[model samples]
Target: MANPRNPNRLPSSSSSSSSSSRSVASPPLSSPPRITTSSRAAPPPPLPSAATPPLPPRLRPPRAAPPLPGLRGLRLRAPGGASLHRTARVFPSPSSYEFEIKEKGSHLLRLHFYPFVARGYDLSSASFHVSASGFTLLANFTTADPVLKEFVLWIDSDKLVLSFVPAQASSFAFVNAIEVVSAPKDLIGDVAIVPNQLEKFNGVSRQALETLYRINVGGPKVTPFNDTLWRTWVPDNELFVESDSTSKTLSFSGRIAYQKYGASREVAPDNVYSTARVVDGSDSNHNMTWVFPVSSGYKYLIRLHFCDIASLALNQLYFNIYVNGNSGYGDFDLSDAAGHVLASPYYIDFVADADNSGKVIVTIGPSKLSSPSWIHGLLNGVEVMKMNNSIGSLDGDASVVLVTENPVKRGFGEFVRSILCGFAFMSLLGIVFMLVMRLRAESGRTVLWSPLPTDVSGGKWGQGFPVASGKLEL
Candidate 1:
């Protein structure tokens, strides 16, 4: 449904009591910061003592926000790390905050919610609808602690509207903060990827560019203040089930990394190259893997970050990559891939269409290609992004091709007469054996398709240690 926001319904301005609450002149702006203003009026004072001279309108500052608890000392802080715990504009009734963005392109909108007692807020009654520019960002959502979600928006105009509406009477709706950041253009198109239809729907576009996880594998969290582009890179420990049991993921000593995805300069912090996740005693039969929890059926663009900081010689380390049992990249030797270079940034991007399990199993194992050199697989960073295709592609809606194209059956006679006959027979057996191994892995493995064990009815907040409950229950 379209946004039903009526500015006339905004909460009335509250009285000012403190010196900081006093307003200054609405700074001389060529134009207002917000194109749309609230439609509420300030409360009137007792007939403004007839004995007093009327004050000039320009001299009077705008009415200050009503005094409320949990609001003091909580000013908006710079956004970079896991969103801060304070800075809020609480809503007792329907409320809205509007902003104007001059840049027109794909933009990422971040909403922060912290259900604390800072503003006499009823944490249990925090159900509400959140919308941006008349589009739904969150609906009837409730949480126990601080939570943040990011969305990719394609803004065509400068005017933007963000609003909150309580779901039930007396239920207060509030926001800790909001942010709008520039995103890569063409990353999201207006075309919708309708299933069963092979083409873009009506030539319109769609984007599934919401960020699910951006992590600095094996490293500490990097806040926007320390990052190159004010981006937040969380540590992988928070989300992955790692095979390594060590107290720390293996460490590396590589140089700086420079990366560019689309038009933006997405640089990995220098610290990003200092650490990596490397499992010991890994082999070709079973590779070390990390399982991430995700929603199923949606398409994802999984990007891997690498920097040979270990100073390994040429072909010193070789590994194979897998995504949900499929070969993401086989026999990937980082140094060889980089032309035997070191201390430089290298990355690979793959698009995966999730299946019913909703989980993506990523494995990095020692490959025969590097077995002669003797080393293990290691990773520096990772990003799993949702895709927004203008064509009829929604991740799972994508089809996989397993058929192999080969020379015509002039081969049928060649198989019996050529020198490759013995070798070809062994190759066939190898394929069969690999198939058996894959089947065994599938049968032995469990994937999560449901909520975590700590998932409560109204919130997914942490409780005790989160244990994997086998595979998702569909």
Candidate 2:
């Protein structure tokens, strides 16, 4: 019924004459059902191509790890979710395959292993060892539990050799995935290493340097997305050796430390700050040491990164830092020295000359005071920068201190070492030592590297590639 107040309403057509006309024009309600359906129903829709519903954007499996990028390995099932699943790689043999990277610099090496056992493999038989360019990255590594590893290495030559040796008991070893990202030339400082000129304190000229190692003292390897420079700072666990009980800790307390130095989450974007290594308070004499091998006669720069995440006073944690047994920093305190918890980080840098032994030793221990220091030894990050005295400094965000002191006096021992290195080892002893040095040589196995020209345009972020998981694994 139309409302009487509505002016737009149509006039009622219920007249005897109109009713008669409608009855004549329209069929009775009892007409056949088929005819009525044909008159009023819509056309059916076209059949669908697929049976199941489409996956949601997030649920869809991502593109699998870029076709080998040059290494050869079977693909494993990564159960860390589709994100990590697609990035998984597996090298079935106990021995490893080495890849050739044409360019050399400080590169971030990321190795991922999701501990989930696949169909045929037993997790218990998964122990193995890994090394890159003669430096052991992980030894006695196991998949008994899931783990993610990241490392920074200097690629000196045109090629990098990556080797994996599974334990005798374990039939095979594998890596779920790997990433080799190029890092900034100067890991800690913006300046470059240049040779000494006339004005320097000592007659010794600075040696050309490169980054042999960069470690995230207490943290996991940060991914490209989380890091502004996409730098990979390896966890110190592999190199960390406890002396009188030193321990590595991950502190939620220091999570926001980078912000204090005016860094936004995007810049200091990873969970690395919360992790740290500290000396054991219970031990009377605790120390933390890491050793690195290098070519003889080169000067190096070592940087120690620090941030106090513990809930103690500034002076509570105090220690001394040493390089090759020489005291570099006498008294180092984190909390007392660094007022902010998650603010920017603090670093101690030193220039060191590698002795004829071709090795550099870095150590941290309790202070020399007769009474024990308030806290314990601690470290957050470490960078071994190679100095290029000839080139001077470039732009990095680290501070470096050069010690132009008298070179450590060496006698006849130096002469003997130089001569001995040139001569070949005795046949029997050389073979024995070679086997003992598991990571020193590469076997006949060669990496496919790339059949075609290489493509590194992916840069730090893996541009043009959809391996979002790789970026997230920083």
Candidate 3:
């Protein structure tokens, strides 16, 4: 009530002196003007703390395994009962023809003619049959029906070659020109048959008119079929010859005393030694036997040709095998005696035991201590087959029979102990048939609670004991 008017009246003193003169002209406000906030220099210290990481070095141990190459397991045998399933064909003609021969009847063929034609024809009047659609050759003309113009035939499995070229004019010539023929005494040999209507005929040459007839029948021959079965061992002073048509080369020698693996040192020729040479006919005696041809159940592979001559330090020789004559080293002791050395040339494989035994004996030496020791050996060829099957006889004589041994694989703790004894005999017969059906359902629930206490007499629990306990609980 006394306010408004009174205050208004007081402030009117020049508005109270201009509100105390604007608070003394606000001049002493230094403290309020000191508001200077420009101090944020704390971000330059994050580049000096990085050096603590060095730990990863511990895992080194595993390196030592290299020494296994010494004819680990050897076996070799194959020479000449002859049919391990033989097959060889090379022909330009030295005369040999075999269309089929798994063993027929008579076999004796030998020819080594190489003079390049001096005039020789009559290869047995030429006629060999084998039917089944193979091996056929026929040529025999006198004159009247002469018209076979040009001819060149070749065969191999035995061998055959024929060459003839005629036809230029025609009249009738060629008299006693039989070159050579032999087969049951068909013997013929003259050489020079030219007359098919002569234009410029003599005996080869019109630039030699493409003529090359060579025939080389059957091999491995030296009287009496050369009695094959391969046998040759050189050491007894050496001097060999099974049959060498002069310089065909089949020589062998013997001399020993150069063992270093067993001490008695003297080494230099490049240091490493083992030598053997005898392809088929050398006789000295370190051991060599061959007669190969087995079928009864075919499976064969035998090879050996250990030759080490410019690096001698020998001491690792042990090989002894014999098939057919039996004795494949029984009670263990293939006899290494104390030798097992090798530097090269070693091939071995064997499988043949179903009774087609013909022959195979080999004995490489130098083991009983191997020193200056003395062991000479040679056997350059052996190969009995019947492996890939398919040649001919299981009953007729071509080849088909193999099963020599290598079948026994069942060990993982005997296949987990036969599946844990067949799952413990079927889980012990399913726990004895569930304990005999829980003791026959607890003896039929104790005979339905003792016949429901005698049918509760009357009604309460009776009625034949609730229909005989609900038909014995179903």
Candidate 4:
């Protein structure tokens, strides 16, 4: 769908009053900045009195209709402290928000939705589909409260377009705010380790990802303001199962060594790497585990952050990492992983599938290769991002057919294979038919005389021949 023509608009999402409501202008064409805009509109001015003197045609104002009820803007706040949920812009038909891209890389797209009574329309009753850059981000999506949707897209084009289409003509579409920010170039890479597979999984940067969970192990919640990318990281106290009584939280007060080849500050804040959840050395046989609920039948990109702050010497701690009972990393030597430097940040990425129970369990247990007195395992932070299904959708099981390959290329390959198979089948049939015809002609070449030319005139051996009567004529 294209941008709506003369679409009805709402109040400004950034302001507190409707008087200042206006559409957010596009950023300059110099370079894409880490900022965004929203859709808004200003209410029409009141009509002048008849007693006033007649003014020029150009000076006279156009007639304005009375504003609809419930069109007034309402103030609200999201859990992340974003004030963009105060107002929204409603579209009676299909519409879009377009952006010009100056640099081509991965960009963060965040959408805020706050359903309410807008004018005479019930925003909660509205069902719509949202798509961006030819990927279906949402399908038949609706909500009662404020909701935020975030996605990371790989854009190698000059423009990024977002379209919103209502499910029905009677229904409407709306948005409170939209954010488009350039993410770090190294935020996402092209490769990951997959469980049970000997080969590495590549092309991870090509797929669109939806943020599922971001957790700071053994630490307090880190809000968006504290993160480099305005991301939120919640604590893992509730996620950690207390039944495993052999685990505890560990904190470091020293500076983290940020190596040139290791994780950077943009990858994770220092607060996340400073604290960790580690297994107590008392119970060497037990493991520290954290369970998370996820949608079944979908794969997730799991990133585990590690900083060896618990160990005092190099090559002292050896542990194993497991995902859903499968070995993700066996005999993981933290000291060796961080290049024999304690407090250096290092992370690992894995592609894991959600089981039937809709649970992804991560366990860190002591490795048999380590001494019994060594600390078993430790983790600093964890991030889980959901990968788009084969149908190219992040929401529901709705299949959206995407044109990823050129039709001409696929058709030519298929045509060549078909022609080769046809020739092979015809050649075999012709050989069998020729062999059958030759055998028939060879059998008919030989002939046998039915009755022997024996003498029957009684001059020679006429008695040896039998007559047509029952008795022989001897």
> Relative to the true structure, how large is the alpha-carbon lDDT of every model?
0.51, 0.47, 0.23, 0.68
Per-model RMSD to reference? 29.5, 33.8, 48.4, 15.2
Cα shift from native, residue 92, model 1 (Å): 5.2
Using TM-score as the measure, the top candidate is 4
RMSD in Å for candidate 3, one decimal?
48.4
- Scored by lDDT, the top model is 4
lDDT of 4 by residue, 200-232 (tens): 879888888888678888887764434445556
- Candidate ranking under lDDT, highest first, comes to 4, 1, 2, 3
Estimate TM-scores for all models: 0.54, 0.39, 0.19, 0.68
Per residue, candidate 3 scores C-alpha lDDT tens digits across 1-474 of: 211101111110000010010000000112121111111122211212242111112111111111222211111121322221111111111121122222222111211111111123322222111111121111122222111111111112332222211111121112111111111111111122111222322211111110111100111211111111011112211122223211122222222233333311111111111223322222222344434334354333333223332223454223344444444322212112213433332333333343545433333322233223323232322323222223322212221111111111224445678999999999999999999999999976674433445546444765443444354454
Candidate 3 wrong stretches, greater than 4 Å? 1-298, 301-319, 322-373, 388-466, 469-474
Candidate 4 wrongly placed segments (more than 4 Å)? 1-82, 399-474
Weakest 10 consecutive residues of candidate 1 by summed lDDT = 1-10
* Ranked candidates, highest TM-score first: 4, 1, 2, 3
Q: Which of the two, 1 or 3, has more TM-score?
A: 1
Runs with alpha carbons beyond 4 Å of true place in candidate 2? 1-209, 259-270, 339-344, 368-374, 389-474
In each prediction, how many residue pairs overlap at the backbone (N, C-alpha, C within less than 3 A)? 12, 33, 48, 0
State how far residue 213 of model 3 sits from its true place (Å): 30
Q: Please report how far candidate 4 places residue 244 from its true position, in Å.
A: 2.8
- At residue 242, candidate 2 shows an lDDT of 52
Q: What is the lDDT of residue 152 in candidate 3?
A: 14
